[model samples]
Target: MAILSDITLYPIKSCAGIALREATLTRAGLMTEGIYDREWMVVDADGNYLTQREHPKLALVTPRIKANTLELRAPGMLRLEIPLGLPDPESAPARTVLLWDLSLKAYDCDDLTAAWFTSFLGLPCRLVRFHPEAQNLANMKWTGGVEAPTLFSDGYPVLVIGAESLRDLNERLHKAGRAPLPMNRFRPNLVVDGLGAYEEDYIDTFDFDGAVLKPVKPCPRCPMPSVDQATGTFGPDPLEILQSYRAKPEVDGGICFGMNNILLEGEGQRVHVGQQVGAELAF
Candidate 1:
């Protein structure tokens, strides 16, 4: 009896995630209060995406959903509030931002908001929102021809990790005289319990009551995991330890952790923590 142990929604790419008791599952990822996962992102002066991989302090930028605004707070920085309403597409300021190989048109945030991020990160950057008309699709090569849409995720709509997987890694860390890391270190969108260690790697689909999530690709590990979510600083990286056993030949020998997923059914369905999950193993 596998249970959905946790649900995390990351409104911004590579920033802190919000733990939710329930969230609406969408093709683009989890959504709550009309805000989709990775709906907003920070970009450099050249419009390239920025992340905790470069600035670990991004983990310290916390967001809270207010009545009509997305309130953001950071260490030693004043609270910044962004309107929840979508701006008019016809006249809203837009910019061409580069996210990996995809070039996307996004709504450029206000100058004040840009200044806030710039001052906090100590870099000239601006925050951008996913444009309503932008079409960001996952690679069909990995999706088996299923057209999976995403916002600013690396390559998938959702990431699912098994709880026992972390426990297994923690046990190894203990043996190596290293500190155990939290689930947030991996930043998975869905965490399932009651599965064997690394069981998610063999799962093909996670069937909830009205939704079906298909595991499409293996999520590769990055140095960003070394960033402590609490301190927003780099610590001893776990990649070396993971490389010893978690490297996958399918992903060209990239060290992997979670499974990148796509919505197979019930796009608008709501999923909650503690709900029973039926995992179908891959043949």
Candidate 2:
């Protein structure tokens, strides 16, 4: 049986993810301690998003949620805590942050938080939370006009990949004399085991109990995967190897890995690791 082997929550976009045994399945994505996946983002002075693609050290910024705060930790930095309370929209400071083509309103965090990020990153940067009222939906072109909601995620609400798929890639890497890669390199929210290699690419929906997630778009890989999650540095790149066989014609020949998913049902359901997931294939 195909089972949910792991569930990861990325409290901040493009940063380290928190592995959870159980989490709430919301329409926007995974939720833990009232924190939604990709709820916070790191941005430059102009409000443009900063990701591991540009700042690989972001991979070392680990986040953990407490009773009423989000605590962040880095290699050489003291832990920083930010309150989890959502500010009143009318009174809180707001900024028009540029996330792809969408310029949505996001609340600017305090100067201390900004200083912490800037000091650690060695660049002027700030942390911003997604506005409570902003409708930051994924591109409808990929969702078939479903208007799936997301926060600071690159595109979709959730990303799913099969564990065997990674094993297959590792096998290839072993044959090529290159070191194997971990799942963190891909940063998927859900990792299912017991499926054939790349079988998630053909699935219609992943059903766990009553929760449903539809795989809508093929996830195109970028150079960010080359950044080692543990070391926060670029190592032997894997895109060169994927380019030989993982290109998807539907995405303009972009080398693809996981499947971009959208929540279709059970918005308030709880999803757990080790739960059996029924895969309804599109075929």
Candidate 3:
């Protein structure tokens, strides 16, 4: 039987993730404590979403939940809080922010929050929460002609990988005398155990009883994995190790770790640890 080995929710785009033993699975992604994954983002002076691609230090900005507020803490910076209350349209600071090709309105957070992020990332940026009016949808081509909503996520709602897949990679690394890697390096939203190596990439859909997810795209790896999940400091890149055999020729030689997935059914379901995952293979 397959069991959910891990659950991760990223509240802010391209920042750290929150690990959970139990979480609510919505059409968009994982939800815990009433907060949806990637529902918040940090934008530059021009209101463009900032990712760890340019500012690796963004990995250090950690978020913790507080009563009625989300507290953020970073190295060498003061603590900051973002009130969970809905913004008042009349008084809220509405600005256009770019997420890939889609431009949308995102309310600017308080100055303290902005300063904390800017100082931490060494960039002139402000924090922004997803506007209720904005529609951030994943590409329809991967959703089997259906539209699924998502927020600040790279492109999909979920990223699923199998533990045996990591074990396979680690086995190779061990033979090569390199240290074994952790699942955090891939930043998967869901990690399933008791599956064969690379089982996820071959899975057409992962149906957690009612919640269905179609793995539509091969998640292209980047330098972000080099950033240590615990220290938030970067080190040796994993691309070299993955380049040996992790390349997906189907994607024209793109290296991948996880599968980018879109929710197909069960919009507001709960996914918990030790839950069985019924997989539908693509081939």
Candidate 2 structure quality by residue, lDDT tens digits, 1-283: 9999999999989889999999999889889878999999999999999999889999999999899999999999999999999998899999989898888889999999999999999999999999977788877998888979999998899999999999999999999999999999999999999999999999989998989999999999999999999999999888888999999999999999999999999998998999999999999
Q: What are the per-residue Cα lDDT tens digits for candidate 1 across 46-89? A: 99999999999999999999999999999999999999999999
Candidate 3 TM-score, C-alpha based: 0.95
TM-score per candidate, chains pooled: 0.99, 0.98, 0.95
Question: By descending lDDT, how would the candidates be arranged?
Answer: 1, 2, 3
By lDDT, the better pick of 2 and 3 is 2
Which predicted model would earn the best TM-score?
1
Write down the lDDT that model 3 would get. Answer: 0.85
Q: Write out the backbone clash pairs for model 1.
A: none
lDDT of 3 by residue, 1-283 (tens): 7788899988988788888888888877888888989989999998888887777777788888778988887788878888977789888997889998899888888898888887887789998988888888877876777787888888888889999989998888888788888888788999999889988888887888788888888888988877777777777777888899889987788889989888778877888888899987888
All-Cα superposition RMSD per candidate = 0.6, 0.8, 1.5
Q: How far does residue 269 in candidate 2 sit from its true spot (Å)?
A: 0.2
Q: Candidate 1: what lDDT?
A: 0.95
lDDT at residue 283 of model 1 (Cα atoms): 82
